[model samples]
Target: MSDAAPLRIPLRPLARILHAREKGENPDAIERENLRLRHEEMRDRARVRAEGRILVLGAVFTLAFLTIGVKMWMVAESEPAEPRTSFAGAGIVAQRGDIVDRQGRVLATNLDTYALYAHPHQMVEPERAAEELVEIFPDLDQERLLKDFTGSRRFVWIRRKISPEQRQAVHDMGEPGLLFGPREMRLYPNGAIAAHVLGGAGYGEEGVAAAEIKGTAGVERAFDDYLTDPANGGKPLELSLDLTVQAAAEEVLYGGMRLMNAKGATSILMDAHTGEIISLVSLPDFDPNDRPNPPTEGHPDDSPLFNRAVQGVYELGSTLKIFAAAQALDLGIVGTDTMVDIRGPIRWGRHTIKDFHWYGKELSVADIIIKSSNIGTARLAEGIGINLQKQFLANLGLFEATPVELSEAPSGAPLIQKNWSELTTMTVSFGHGMSISPLHLAAAYATIANDGKRVRPTLLRQTGPQDGPQVISAAAARQSQRLLRQVVTEGTASFADIDFYSIAGKTGTADKPKPTGGYYNDKTISTFASMFPAHDPQYVLIVTLDEAVETSGDEPRRTAGWTAVPVAAELVTRIGPLLGLRPEIAPVPLADITLTSN
Candidate 1:
């Protein structure tokens, strides 16, 4: 094969020979054979070129698939991203709108927690599980828990709110019955700071998969519809309360209550201009976070659950004299200089009105307020008469429910005798026969302080100028302020006088009515109703103690000046600076001020 030489055809001769074969005409045989060889070579070259193109396309496809696979591997190896959630979706905490103070401090809010549950039917070694649980939570009754664990129930609450540690312990127990799920719990961040004002939220029906909380009392109950509505739940509810003022008032009031060995106490601080409640303290307040169950037996009426500020109605004692004097002044029946003979007790049809301390002196209208004279006040009330006194009390909101933003507020129509006897007029004038809520008295004082404007007391923050109707002439209100100032400088409420703050207030010590149908001379409701910065009159604060008893070795005095006045004074001292009040004691002029009886 190496010795034989192959012959190649020339271009023109090979082409012609191929054309002759196609026509079936015979030509040179050598050229025809060469042409056939050339044509075979060309077909082979074309086949090789087609194979090269297909191999290149396959390589490109392979590269693309390899890149895609590498990307998928990278994604799988990385940590998975968290899934987004919404309130409307399950497993998300759904709660009421937040309750915040005027400064945006959260008063009431929701806390996300785990609710422990169990499936007794699925439990294995339930005795062991109950034993372990009781070890974790000593409060859980072992016997009761053992019963729940061994029962055939599908689901049972082990605990409402459990810590992460407790949950891990339960999970580690390897018990099939133990389980935990998401829950929303209403939390009062300040604990019992404003418990009575914020109230509390209660859980929905038992055995419900989804837990819902509804407001039960106080502002929570009052604004439940707005708070629970999905559209409004995101927006916070703002209140007029100042936590600093509230804390101060509570500290002083509670101190006084305990020191006096009193039954209960209530204190209120309100803005004179807008009637916004700055602070309201009712002692023995329940913790809104964990409200106690109602007592099984005994009198529910004696329960601390009652809000003494607005829900309680009391005689309010000589505090009502402030209103009586104001009414007298407004009606032009008595001027500050007008004199009244209070040396003798005024005898009515079935009763006699006498001052607690008879000085046998004639008292002016200012002196009547300064001395808190029941006899003088009764004489003035007699002049105003029953109808005018009724109208005056009505205007002051004593004849109706306080329009405060509380659902539990009392609709206390003043406890009045329907007969409207002369004796009733005398007693009512000195805050004896008629009973009214402390809030009613506070609102009335706020009216006098706000230049005779009748303001509707509000818990919501005020945004605009209050459109309160003018209840008395500004001139008369000014005169009333002067007399009120004298009450602190030279009158009965000297103990409440903060020299720097120019405090003006009234002291009231009323005999508490016995449940057995008579007044208790030994027990009394001592109260102080006051306004600070007397000349400008910005805030009205009222402190009341139920059944205050004096233990001071000097005397067993159950009077407001001895108990409530000092409380008010201390509260003002603490909160005045917080409220931006400067203390500059300018001595009140005493040129014509006198309280001598004829």
Candidate 2:
């Protein structure tokens, strides 16, 4: 029974068993499912890993970017800051002190101004900027502006000391790189009236010329240090020169020059008691503001820039007779009663000294001075001896420049070298060989007017009496004054006399030295040195003309009386009233000092 059953094992039973086995789970099917689930898990893990890698990469990139930014900022912070270009925050420009005349008139002053500059690198469009700039400043070259703009240089100057209108116009252009610098500008409002005394200003309104405008030629250059003190920024420089007086002097000098057709002229007025320069004029003067302008040309070939009062040197001719009389009296070599025989010409070795007007008889010392006798002067100088004469001349400042508050070349005195040959002594005695500046002559005359105390001439007003070394005795000075008065009242300086005041002075005409030694026969320098109110002197005035030419009259000869004396008279007459000196009645006894022909 078992064999039959097994064989027939019911194909149904076997099918049922196989179906149960498949439904319950075959091992291989289970395994395959597990493997698929595991594969899916592995794929999920791989996707997570790729996402993590992407996040890491992003973090690394961000860190790198941050490091670079931090480094750049550090470098920027470490660099040095640039220097400031504007002068505003730096400091205010110091103002220079004012310059005024004795009468309180302003002579020099400073004005506020702006200077223009540019930073080329800051300009965005250089060509357009330059064009705009040229429009504002027509003087500026477009090509130059473009070149300057494109240049590597950061800063450059456009213009210095521009006016307010010009500065505003430049600012209105809205130039990006343009800048304005603060500055000051010096101004001389009086123009050329006192140009010789008021020197010019420099860049940045600094005092460079004329020693701080003390007296560049006449007084500015002389008192430069006093006028300009960097520590003090300068104090007010009050001068003895009165503007009204200076103007009057200039007018007279200019008129005289024009009328005489003179090449050049100079005039000076000083207080006899104090040796203060009241008014001084150098003809053909240039405007201090227009210092760049070329000097006036043509004439006796005179240089307007030259200060004849202090710079020019000349033989003073008969004017030396004043000093001769002073020296003779001072040395006790002669007195008013002392007499000297005057012949036609006195022969001294090879040179013969002659007088323009020969007395041909005995003449007193007073007569010699009034007549301006060259022969008489030579005799007096010879009696005084060379050494004594040299000392006298030196004491009178003839050997050196007049010690004023101005720069000056020393007077050309051959006596300084002490080359006293007979001819040299005789020629110097008559003012032929020795040369002195007009300023020197003026100062010497002032000493006589002030009664022999040689006060140093000053352009600055004296706060008190001037202190200086005395050069001559009062008695000698009185005698010299008396002799000088005689000359003006009746001698060569008659033209200098004024009706209101008794004037005393001497006239001089010396032949100009030739280029090849000796003196030119025709060319001459004419001079007049005088003092007003001769009895009690108040002012000393001097006038000089270089190679003046006479344009009128039958005789075209230029003489001291015709060329220089008239200028002196006009200046004294015009300036006296302005200087607080009034016209008064002439004293009776003092008028007795008139020259008389023996």
RMSD of each: 11.9, 16.8
- Model 1 residue-pair collision total: 4
lDDT of 1 at 197: 87
Worst 10 residues of 2 by lDDT: 205-214
Residues 38-151, candidate 2: write the lDDT tens digits.
Answer: 688779989999999999999999999999999999988895653332345443233456678997898987777777888888877788878987887899999998999899
- The candidate maximizing TM-score is 1
> Model 1, 410-510: lDDT tens per residue?
54445666788777888888888888878888999888888888877889998864768888878788888888888888977888776567788888888
The residue ranges of model 1 lying beyond 4 angstroms of the native Cα positions read: 1-93, 206-209, 299-301, 411-414, 585-598
Q: Which ten residues in a row have the lowest lDDT in candidate 1?
A: 84-93
Q: How far in Å is the alpha carbon of 218 misplaced in model 2?
A: 6.9
